[model samples]
Target: MRIEIWADVVCGWAYIGKRRLEAALADPAFDGVPVEVVWRPFRIDPTSPARSTPLEEALADPAVDNALRVCAPGLSPGENRTRVSDIAAAEGIGPRWGAAWRASSHDAHRLLFLAHEHGGAELQNAVAERVMRAHFVDGADIGDRRTLAAVAAEAGFADGAALLETGAGEDEVRELLLIGKARGVATSPTIVVGDRALAGAQPAEVIREFIARGGHRRELPDEVERLRHAEALLDRRDPLGSLVLLRPLLDAYGDDRNVLMLAARAYFASAQLGRARATLERLVGDTPDDSYARHLLGRTLQRQGLAEEAAPHLSMAAAMSPEYD
Candidate 1:
């Protein structure tokens, strides 16, 4: 069996969900099930600025406070580090949420994507586990490249600094975000099993029930895999390589959403702004509710010096995916 979990590093419930899933897999019933788990990237604050926000200020926001309370019941509307700490302690996963939990998780996700690409599932899981612990326990700013590099190094990456400096895995991270959004993953800690999904921190028993139901393993088709490789090429800062793969796929699968999105990305990365605009416009027209498409379309227009036309799309994209800032 395989499980794909879409979650953000800063999401408290995602940490809890990870623990619950671990417990479920540890159950005697699943002792020999031989499961594969993959973590997919989802940004909790994609629009967060590069600078860090004070944790207290973030906690003071009603929405943020509410989310914290949902993850750790009885958490007050103000700074409730103690309450969050207690919750983390109960799960045996941390030092606790504290002053260090403020920052965008975009960069952290990029590192994770790189880990998965370079070291496979075990390494990716290790990196993700450490990142979540850093954010929710030790209160480390996962957004900072240095912090992420340290975590990656500990997770067995020998050249974390170089990877960060090169901006490796960024395009893959963005592509994963779009894939998650298109798959209807609107919340952190959403575990998809075959066609069914379990959202939030579900109990171990619930997870076991899902296991018994037996979901089909999620696998990308060959064409989609080609598109994914193209995205990775783009992430490596190779626009020409990405376009080589994408252009052929576009010719063959012109209307396929994933193909179009990858082609648009390739064009944008290569500075073929007009082609990008045309592709994105068609994508947005086909899937109006796709937040990623709208966001990219807005960016494409903005790059073409059409900010006036891009503003509404950008605003709507942000509104639709508020977690992205």
Candidate 2:
């Protein structure tokens, strides 16, 4: 079966776990019955607001960073603050990350949903990395709708604005928490395999051994504590608490052209005209029958100060749908 991962985009341990899982999956030893990894959202900072500052001082709290290190090892939390942007550009899987220091969890979770819709676990990994890089490394404000939308556009995701406006992930966050409770997850990086519940980042060999056993046993170590504080701290209504869950899955799984066009909407909202134009142009040309594509393309073209050029696409869109302006 596929491997389902419960994690937050901002968690360093989750990143480490992701790398570990990738290594395992790539290993020639497990080549035949390879596992497809699913990145399930279990938001750690549900209450965090957009452009929120670090909880600790400017230097990053050593205690929390140490905790992550215990789970993964050799982690330097502040290091991310320095390298987030360069990493985002190089990785190209995540959105733009610059030094934006806010504690907004909504953007992180929302983009995860977007990535989920694009393909599956593979797409999720790419999407999650992009948004996280923006939040954790770039210090970008994840709380702003424009910021979120811009990041989504950069990552080739759906209109982040529409999803935020519609409050897409509002219910999903609550549901995922419930699932975590039922499964007895207490920490940031707990991974469940069938009945097996893994606490902490854990050693790869230990996780491998557990997986090798067919994952029938669930472990709740004495140190096991569920993820509680992080959620309460990050979830705020201004950005909308219920909204985080909805944001990630809307137009996620990037395979659909319509979704790509929708992502263009977010990009446009975020003022990423170049990418927005590119996405809309590609979608309109590839799927001329899609009225949504024509409409979005027309809007994108008009925004670029090409009203005459946009007229045809707008007309086609109007013809395809009686209500379209």
**Model 1: per-residue Cα lDDT over 161-208, one tens digit each:** 588789787777876776565456778889998878887778888987
Lowest lDDT sum, 10 consecutive residues, model 1, at 75-84
Q: Model 2 over residues 207-269: C-alpha lDDT tens digits?
A: 776666666444453212122211231232111222232234333544554345445665666
**TM-scores of all predicted structures:** 0.66, 0.51
Alpha-carbon lDDT, every model: 0.79, 0.60
User: Which residue pairs in model 1 clash with each other?
Assistant: 47-324, 96-137, 100-139
Best by TM-score: 1
Worst 10 residues of 2 by lDDT: 222-231
List RMSD in Å for every model shown: 10.7, 19.0
Model 1, runs deviating above 4 Å? 59-76, 79-85, 217-220, 224-248, 251-325
- Model 1: lDDT to the true structure: 0.79
Best by lDDT: 1
